[model samples]
Target: MSDESNQTEGPIAGISDVPVTLTVSVGRARPTVGELLSLTADDIFTLDKSLDDPVDLYVGDHLVGRGVLEELDEPGSGRLGIRITEIAPIKDLV
Candidate 1:
Protein backbone atom coordinates (compact mmCIF):
# COMPACT_ATOMS: atom_id res chain seq x y z
CA MET A 1 0.00 0.00 0.00
CA SER A 2 1.07 3.56 -0.63
CA ASP A 3 2.26 5.74 2.28
CA GLU A 4 -0.71 8.04 1.92
CA SER A 5 -3.12 5.14 2.24
CA ASN A 6 -1.42 3.86 5.39
CA GLN A 7 -1.62 7.21 7.16
CA THR A 8 -4.93 7.98 8.79
CA GLU A 9 -6.04 11.37 10.09
CA GLY A 10 -5.22 12.15 13.67
CA PRO A 11 -7.47 13.89 16.25
CA ILE A 12 -9.33 16.98 15.22
CA ALA A 13 -6.68 19.59 14.47
CA GLY A 14 -8.29 22.47 16.31
CA ILE A 15 -8.94 20.79 19.63
CA SER A 16 -5.33 20.03 20.52
CA ASP A 17 -4.90 23.36 22.26
CA VAL A 18 -7.93 22.92 24.51
CA PRO A 19 -7.33 23.04 28.22
CA VAL A 20 -7.47 19.87 30.32
CA THR A 21 -6.78 18.92 33.88
CA LEU A 22 -3.68 16.85 34.67
CA THR A 23 -3.30 15.15 38.05
CA VAL A 24 -0.29 13.67 39.74
CA SER A 25 -0.91 11.09 42.41
CA VAL A 26 1.77 10.83 45.06
CA GLY A 27 0.04 8.09 47.02
CA ARG A 28 -3.00 7.18 49.07
CA ALA A 29 -3.67 6.58 52.77
CA ARG A 30 -6.65 5.41 54.78
CA PRO A 31 -7.01 7.27 58.05
CA THR A 32 -9.14 6.07 60.93
CA VAL A 33 -11.77 8.27 62.54
CA GLY A 34 -9.64 8.88 65.60
CA GLU A 35 -6.60 9.64 63.48
CA LEU A 36 -8.56 12.03 61.32
CA LEU A 37 -10.06 13.82 64.29
CA SER A 38 -6.77 14.10 66.16
CA LEU A 39 -5.01 15.89 63.32
CA THR A 40 -3.18 19.08 64.23
CA ALA A 41 -1.39 21.78 62.27
CA ASP A 42 1.96 19.97 62.46
CA ASP A 43 0.66 16.50 61.73
CA ILE A 44 2.21 14.55 58.90
CA PHE A 45 0.46 11.72 57.12
CA THR A 46 2.55 9.22 55.17
CA LEU A 47 1.64 8.14 51.68
CA ASP A 48 2.07 4.73 50.07
CA LYS A 49 4.54 5.97 47.43
CA SER A 50 8.17 6.75 47.92
CA LEU A 51 10.32 9.60 46.61
CA ASP A 52 11.85 7.57 43.80
CA ASP A 53 8.54 6.32 42.44
CA PRO A 54 6.86 7.99 39.46
CA VAL A 55 3.52 9.78 39.94
CA ASP A 56 0.44 9.02 37.90
CA LEU A 57 -1.28 11.83 35.93
CA TYR A 58 -5.01 11.90 35.44
CA VAL A 59 -7.44 14.02 33.42
CA GLY A 60 -10.79 13.96 35.20
CA ASP A 61 -10.68 10.23 36.13
CA HIS A 62 -8.81 8.69 33.21
CA LEU A 63 -5.06 8.35 33.40
CA VAL A 64 -3.23 10.24 30.68
CA GLY A 65 0.40 10.12 31.71
CA ARG A 66 3.01 9.55 34.37
CA GLY A 67 5.59 11.99 35.65
CA VAL A 68 8.05 12.84 38.37
CA LEU A 69 7.49 15.51 40.95
CA GLU A 70 9.83 18.48 41.08
CA GLU A 71 10.23 21.56 43.19
CA LEU A 72 10.96 24.91 41.63
CA ASP A 73 12.87 27.75 43.22
CA GLU A 74 12.95 31.18 41.59
CA PRO A 75 13.19 33.86 44.22
CA GLY A 76 9.53 34.22 45.26
CA SER A 77 8.12 31.45 43.12
CA GLY A 78 8.38 28.30 45.17
CA ARG A 79 6.03 25.84 43.55
CA LEU A 80 5.73 22.11 42.97
CA GLY A 81 5.55 20.86 39.40
CA ILE A 82 5.56 17.63 37.42
CA ARG A 83 7.94 16.68 34.68
CA ILE A 84 6.16 14.22 32.45
CA THR A 85 8.24 11.09 32.17
CA GLU A 86 5.98 9.00 30.00
CA ILE A 87 2.80 9.64 28.09
CA ALA A 88 0.09 7.10 27.48
CA PRO A 89 -0.60 5.91 23.97
CA ILE A 90 -3.19 7.89 22.00
CA LYS A 91 -5.43 4.87 21.88
CA ASP A 92 -5.29 4.55 25.66
CA LEU A 93 -6.47 8.15 26.17
CA VAL A 94 -9.55 7.44 24.15
Candidate 2:
Protein backbone atom coordinates (compact mmCIF):
# COMPACT_ATOMS: atom_id res chain seq x y z
CA MET A 1 0.00 0.00 0.00
CA SER A 2 1.26 3.48 -0.93
CA ASP A 3 1.69 6.20 1.73
CA GLU A 4 -0.80 8.45 -0.06
CA SER A 5 -3.44 5.73 -0.20
CA ASN A 6 -3.03 4.97 3.52
CA GLN A 7 -3.26 8.64 4.53
CA THR A 8 -6.97 9.38 4.47
CA GLU A 9 -8.93 11.98 6.40
CA GLY A 10 -10.24 11.04 9.82
CA PRO A 11 -13.93 10.40 10.30
CA ILE A 12 -14.71 13.52 12.36
CA ALA A 13 -12.06 15.90 11.01
CA GLY A 14 -14.28 18.70 9.81
CA ILE A 15 -16.89 18.70 12.60
CA SER A 16 -14.43 18.19 15.42
CA ASP A 17 -15.18 21.58 16.91
CA VAL A 18 -18.96 21.04 16.87
CA PRO A 19 -20.60 20.84 20.28
CA VAL A 20 -22.71 17.96 21.52
CA THR A 21 -24.60 17.38 24.74
CA LEU A 22 -23.58 14.47 26.94
CA THR A 23 -25.85 13.27 29.71
CA VAL A 24 -25.10 10.77 32.44
CA SER A 25 -27.99 8.75 33.75
CA VAL A 26 -27.58 7.44 37.24
CA GLY A 27 -30.87 5.63 37.10
CA ARG A 28 -34.59 6.07 36.43
CA ALA A 29 -37.86 6.35 38.29
CA ARG A 30 -41.46 5.77 37.32
CA PRO A 31 -43.98 8.14 38.78
CA THR A 32 -47.66 8.52 38.12
CA VAL A 33 -49.10 11.82 36.92
CA GLY A 34 -50.63 12.54 40.30
CA GLU A 35 -47.45 11.56 42.10
CA LEU A 36 -45.43 13.81 39.82
CA LEU A 37 -47.81 16.68 40.36
CA SER A 38 -47.75 16.18 44.11
CA LEU A 39 -44.00 16.61 44.32
CA THR A 40 -43.03 19.31 46.83
CA ALA A 41 -39.88 21.38 46.99
CA ASP A 42 -38.29 19.15 49.61
CA ASP A 43 -39.57 15.89 48.14
CA ILE A 44 -37.20 13.50 46.45
CA PHE A 45 -37.60 11.16 43.54
CA THR A 46 -35.40 8.14 43.99
CA LEU A 47 -33.57 6.35 41.19
CA ASP A 48 -33.20 2.61 40.67
CA LYS A 49 -29.42 2.36 40.54
CA SER A 50 -27.11 2.58 43.50
CA LEU A 51 -24.20 4.99 43.84
CA ASP A 52 -21.59 2.36 42.87
CA ASP A 53 -23.32 1.22 39.70
CA PRO A 54 -22.09 2.46 36.34
CA VAL A 55 -24.18 5.20 34.82
CA ASP A 56 -25.18 5.34 31.16
CA LEU A 57 -23.81 8.22 29.09
CA TYR A 58 -25.99 9.52 26.30
CA VAL A 59 -25.30 11.71 23.31
CA GLY A 60 -28.74 13.14 22.67
CA ASP A 61 -31.12 10.25 23.20
CA HIS A 62 -28.62 7.66 22.04
CA LEU A 63 -26.64 5.82 24.72
CA VAL A 64 -23.02 5.99 23.53
CA GLY A 65 -21.22 4.84 26.67
CA ARG A 66 -21.25 4.16 30.40
CA GLY A 67 -19.33 5.74 33.26
CA VAL A 68 -19.05 6.28 36.98
CA LEU A 69 -20.04 9.45 38.75
CA GLU A 70 -17.27 11.44 40.39
CA GLU A 71 -17.04 14.58 42.47
CA LEU A 72 -14.61 17.42 41.92
CA ASP A 73 -13.48 19.19 45.07
CA GLU A 74 -12.59 22.59 43.69
CA PRO A 75 -11.69 25.33 46.15
CA GLY A 76 -14.34 27.74 45.01
CA SER A 77 -16.81 25.61 43.10
CA GLY A 78 -17.37 21.95 43.79
CA ARG A 79 -18.74 20.15 40.75
CA LEU A 80 -19.83 16.69 39.66
CA GLY A 81 -18.27 14.78 36.80
CA ILE A 82 -18.16 11.36 35.22
CA ARG A 83 -15.32 8.97 34.54
CA ILE A 84 -16.07 6.98 31.40
CA THR A 85 -15.77 3.27 31.96
CA GLU A 86 -16.90 1.62 28.73
CA ILE A 87 -18.11 2.60 25.29
CA ALA A 88 -21.14 1.00 23.71
CA PRO A 89 -20.51 -1.42 20.90
CA ILE A 90 -20.98 -0.04 17.40
CA LYS A 91 -23.86 -2.43 16.80
CA ASP A 92 -25.52 -1.29 20.01
CA LEU A 93 -25.78 2.29 18.74
CA VAL A 94 -27.63 1.24 15.60
Candidate 3:
Protein backbone atom coordinates (compact mmCIF):
# COMPACT_ATOMS: atom_id res chain seq x y z
CA MET A 1 0.00 0.00 0.00
CA SER A 2 2.74 2.38 -0.93
CA ASP A 3 4.52 3.84 -3.93
CA GLU A 4 3.97 6.87 -1.85
CA SER A 5 0.38 5.77 -1.51
CA ASN A 6 -0.07 5.38 -5.26
CA GLN A 7 1.44 8.74 -5.95
CA THR A 8 -0.72 10.56 -3.47
CA GLU A 9 -3.93 9.25 -5.01
CA GLY A 10 -3.58 10.84 -8.40
CA PRO A 11 -3.63 14.55 -8.38
CA ILE A 12 -3.04 14.33 -12.10
CA ALA A 13 -0.66 11.45 -11.48
CA GLY A 14 2.81 12.61 -12.39
CA ILE A 15 1.91 15.33 -14.84
CA SER A 16 -0.21 12.91 -16.89
CA ASP A 17 2.14 12.90 -19.84
CA VAL A 18 2.48 16.63 -19.77
CA PRO A 19 1.80 18.56 -22.92
CA VAL A 20 -0.54 21.48 -23.27
CA THR A 21 -1.17 23.77 -26.14
CA LEU A 22 -4.68 23.95 -27.46
CA THR A 23 -5.61 27.26 -28.92
CA VAL A 24 -8.22 27.59 -31.61
CA SER A 25 -9.69 31.02 -31.36
CA VAL A 26 -11.05 31.47 -34.82
CA GLY A 27 -11.64 35.16 -35.06
CA ARG A 28 -9.93 38.43 -34.37
CA ALA A 29 -8.74 41.17 -36.67
CA ARG A 30 -7.40 44.56 -35.84
CA PRO A 31 -5.77 45.43 -39.09
CA THR A 32 -4.05 48.73 -38.89
CA VAL A 33 -0.45 49.41 -39.51
CA GLY A 34 -1.79 50.89 -42.66
CA GLU A 35 -4.01 47.86 -42.72
CA LEU A 36 -1.08 45.64 -41.89
CA LEU A 37 1.25 47.02 -44.52
CA SER A 38 -1.34 46.95 -47.28
CA LEU A 39 -1.33 43.25 -47.91
CA THR A 40 -1.90 42.10 -51.46
CA ALA A 41 -2.44 38.46 -52.15
CA ASP A 42 -6.14 37.88 -52.23
CA ASP A 43 -6.48 40.45 -49.51
CA ILE A 44 -9.43 40.22 -47.20
CA PHE A 45 -9.52 41.34 -43.63
CA THR A 46 -12.67 41.50 -41.61
CA LEU A 47 -13.20 39.53 -38.47
CA ASP A 48 -14.57 40.24 -35.08
CA LYS A 49 -16.55 37.07 -35.60
CA SER A 50 -19.21 36.04 -38.07
CA LEU A 51 -19.92 32.76 -39.76
CA ASP A 52 -22.06 31.44 -36.96
CA ASP A 53 -19.44 32.49 -34.49
CA PRO A 54 -18.53 30.15 -31.61
CA VAL A 55 -14.89 29.34 -31.63
CA ASP A 56 -12.62 29.97 -28.72
CA LEU A 57 -10.67 27.25 -27.03
CA TYR A 58 -7.49 28.18 -25.36
CA VAL A 59 -5.18 26.67 -22.84
CA GLY A 60 -2.85 29.55 -22.27
CA ASP A 61 -5.05 32.58 -21.99
CA HIS A 62 -7.43 30.10 -20.37
CA LEU A 63 -10.85 30.44 -21.97
CA VAL A 64 -10.83 26.60 -22.17
CA GLY A 65 -13.67 25.78 -24.59
CA ARG A 66 -16.35 26.73 -27.10
CA GLY A 67 -16.32 25.56 -30.64
CA VAL A 68 -18.16 25.06 -33.91
CA LEU A 69 -16.10 25.33 -37.02
CA GLU A 70 -15.55 22.20 -38.91
CA GLU A 71 -14.57 21.16 -42.37
CA LEU A 72 -12.86 17.85 -42.84
CA ASP A 73 -14.01 16.25 -46.05
CA GLU A 74 -11.59 13.39 -45.38
CA PRO A 75 -10.77 12.48 -48.94
CA GLY A 76 -7.45 14.27 -49.07
CA SER A 77 -7.78 15.45 -45.48
CA GLY A 78 -8.75 19.04 -46.08
CA ARG A 79 -8.24 19.73 -42.43
CA LEU A 80 -9.86 22.18 -40.01
CA GLY A 81 -11.87 20.88 -37.13
CA ILE A 82 -13.56 21.92 -33.95
CA ARG A 83 -17.03 21.20 -32.76
CA ILE A 84 -16.95 21.30 -28.98
CA THR A 85 -19.85 23.74 -28.38
CA GLU A 86 -19.16 24.93 -24.83
CA ILE A 87 -17.30 23.78 -21.74
CA ALA A 88 -15.65 26.28 -19.49
CA PRO A 89 -16.11 25.33 -15.94
CA ILE A 90 -13.60 23.34 -14.06
CA LYS A 91 -13.29 26.47 -12.06
CA ASP A 92 -13.05 28.10 -15.47
CA LEU A 93 -10.21 25.84 -16.47
CA VAL A 94 -7.96 26.90 -13.66
Candidate 4:
Protein backbone atom coordinates (compact mmCIF):
# COMPACT_ATOMS: atom_id res chain seq x y z
CA MET A 1 0.00 0.00 0.00
CA SER A 2 1.11 3.54 -0.75
CA ASP A 3 1.07 6.29 1.89
CA GLU A 4 -0.14 8.89 -0.63
CA SER A 5 -3.17 6.75 -1.43
CA ASN A 6 -4.55 7.24 2.08
CA GLN A 7 -4.65 11.05 1.75
CA THR A 8 -7.67 12.85 0.30
CA GLU A 9 -8.04 16.27 -1.35
CA GLY A 10 -11.43 17.23 0.16
CA PRO A 11 -12.92 17.79 3.58
CA ILE A 12 -14.46 14.69 5.18
CA ALA A 13 -18.24 14.61 5.11
CA GLY A 14 -21.02 12.74 6.94
CA ILE A 15 -19.70 12.17 10.41
CA SER A 16 -23.19 11.04 11.16
CA ASP A 17 -25.08 9.92 14.25
CA VAL A 18 -27.61 8.23 12.00
CA PRO A 19 -29.05 4.87 12.96
CA VAL A 20 -30.18 2.22 10.48
CA THR A 21 -31.65 -1.21 10.49
CA LEU A 22 -31.23 -4.35 8.40
CA THR A 23 -33.78 -7.06 7.86
CA VAL A 24 -34.08 -10.11 5.64
CA SER A 25 -37.17 -11.92 4.49
CA VAL A 26 -37.83 -15.53 3.68
CA GLY A 27 -41.03 -14.51 1.83
CA ARG A 28 -43.29 -12.98 4.52
CA ALA A 29 -45.63 -15.78 5.47
CA ARG A 30 -45.39 -14.70 9.09
CA PRO A 31 -47.94 -16.17 11.48
CA THR A 32 -50.56 -14.40 13.55
CA VAL A 33 -50.08 -13.88 17.30
CA GLY A 34 -52.04 -17.01 18.30
CA GLU A 35 -50.47 -19.15 15.55
CA LEU A 36 -47.02 -17.77 16.41
CA LEU A 37 -47.30 -18.89 20.03
CA SER A 38 -48.11 -22.39 18.92
CA LEU A 39 -45.08 -22.70 16.66
CA THR A 40 -42.16 -24.96 17.55
CA ALA A 41 -39.00 -26.31 15.93
CA ASP A 42 -40.87 -29.02 14.08
CA ASP A 43 -43.59 -26.74 12.69
CA ILE A 44 -43.81 -25.41 9.11
CA PHE A 45 -45.27 -22.20 7.73
CA THR A 46 -45.40 -21.35 4.02
CA LEU A 47 -44.30 -18.08 2.45
CA ASP A 48 -46.73 -15.87 0.53
CA LYS A 49 -44.12 -14.67 -1.93
CA SER A 50 -42.56 -16.78 -4.61
CA LEU A 51 -38.92 -17.90 -4.43
CA ASP A 52 -37.91 -16.16 -7.71
CA ASP A 53 -39.45 -12.84 -6.75
CA PRO A 54 -37.28 -9.85 -5.81
CA VAL A 55 -37.02 -9.56 -2.04
CA ASP A 56 -38.03 -6.28 -0.45
CA LEU A 57 -35.84 -4.67 2.22
CA TYR A 58 -36.64 -1.72 4.43
CA VAL A 59 -35.09 0.54 7.03
CA GLY A 60 -37.90 1.09 9.46
CA ASP A 61 -40.83 1.28 6.98
CA HIS A 62 -38.92 2.97 4.17
CA LEU A 63 -37.68 0.97 1.23
CA VAL A 64 -33.88 1.08 1.13
CA GLY A 65 -32.63 -1.59 -1.20
CA ARG A 66 -33.28 -4.67 -3.32
CA GLY A 67 -31.39 -7.86 -3.97
CA VAL A 68 -31.28 -11.53 -4.71
CA LEU A 69 -29.72 -13.87 -2.21
CA GLU A 70 -26.20 -15.18 -2.41
CA GLU A 71 -24.56 -17.52 0.07
CA LEU A 72 -22.02 -16.22 2.50
CA ASP A 73 -19.91 -17.74 5.32
CA GLU A 74 -21.46 -21.13 4.57
CA PRO A 75 -24.28 -22.95 2.78
CA GLY A 76 -27.03 -21.79 5.10
CA SER A 77 -25.71 -18.23 5.35
CA GLY A 78 -26.30 -15.69 2.58
CA ARG A 79 -26.00 -12.01 1.70
CA LEU A 80 -28.24 -9.79 -0.42
CA GLY A 81 -26.95 -8.64 -3.79
CA ILE A 82 -28.34 -5.11 -3.06
CA ARG A 83 -29.08 -3.88 -6.55
CA ILE A 84 -30.53 -0.40 -7.31
CA THR A 85 -30.19 0.65 -3.68
CA GLU A 86 -29.90 4.04 -2.03
CA ILE A 87 -30.22 5.44 1.46
CA ALA A 88 -31.48 9.01 1.56
CA PRO A 89 -29.88 10.87 4.48
CA ILE A 90 -31.95 10.72 7.64
CA LYS A 91 -31.96 14.50 8.01
CA ASP A 92 -34.04 14.70 4.84
CA LEU A 93 -36.84 12.87 6.62
CA VAL A 94 -36.73 15.25 9.54
Superior candidate under TM-score, 2 versus 4: 2
Residue-level lDDT of model 2, residues 1-94, one tens digit each, is 3455554355644554568988888899998999988988988888999999999999889999998978878654668888888999766755
Clashing pairs in 3: none
The C-alpha RMSD of each candidate to the native structure, in angstroms, is 6.1, 5.5, 12.6, 5.8
The global C-alpha lDDT for each of the candidates, from Candidate 1 onward, is 0.82, 0.81, 0.79, 0.60
TM-score of each: 0.72, 0.74, 0.29, 0.52
lDDT per residue (tens digit) for residues 18-66 in model 4 = 4577665547776899999887898988888777666766767766556
Q: Considering TM-score, where higher is better, how would the candidates rank from best to worst?
A: 2, 1, 4, 3
- lDDT tens digits by residue: candidate 3, 1-94: 3456445233455664568999888799988898778798999988999988998999899898898988788656778789898888665554
How many Å off is the CA of 86 in candidate 4?
A: 8.7
lDDT of 1 by residue, 1-94 (tens): 3455555457644465568877778899888999999999998889999998999999888888899978778755769888899998888876
Number of clashes found in candidate 3:
0
Candidate 3 yields a Cα-based lDDT of 0.79
Better of 2 and 3 by TM-score: 2
Which residue pairs show collisions in model 4? none
Clashing pairs in 1: none
Those runs of model 4 whose alpha carbons end farther than 4 Å from true positions after fitting are 1-19, 30-34, 73-94
Q: Number of clashing pairs, model 1? A: 0
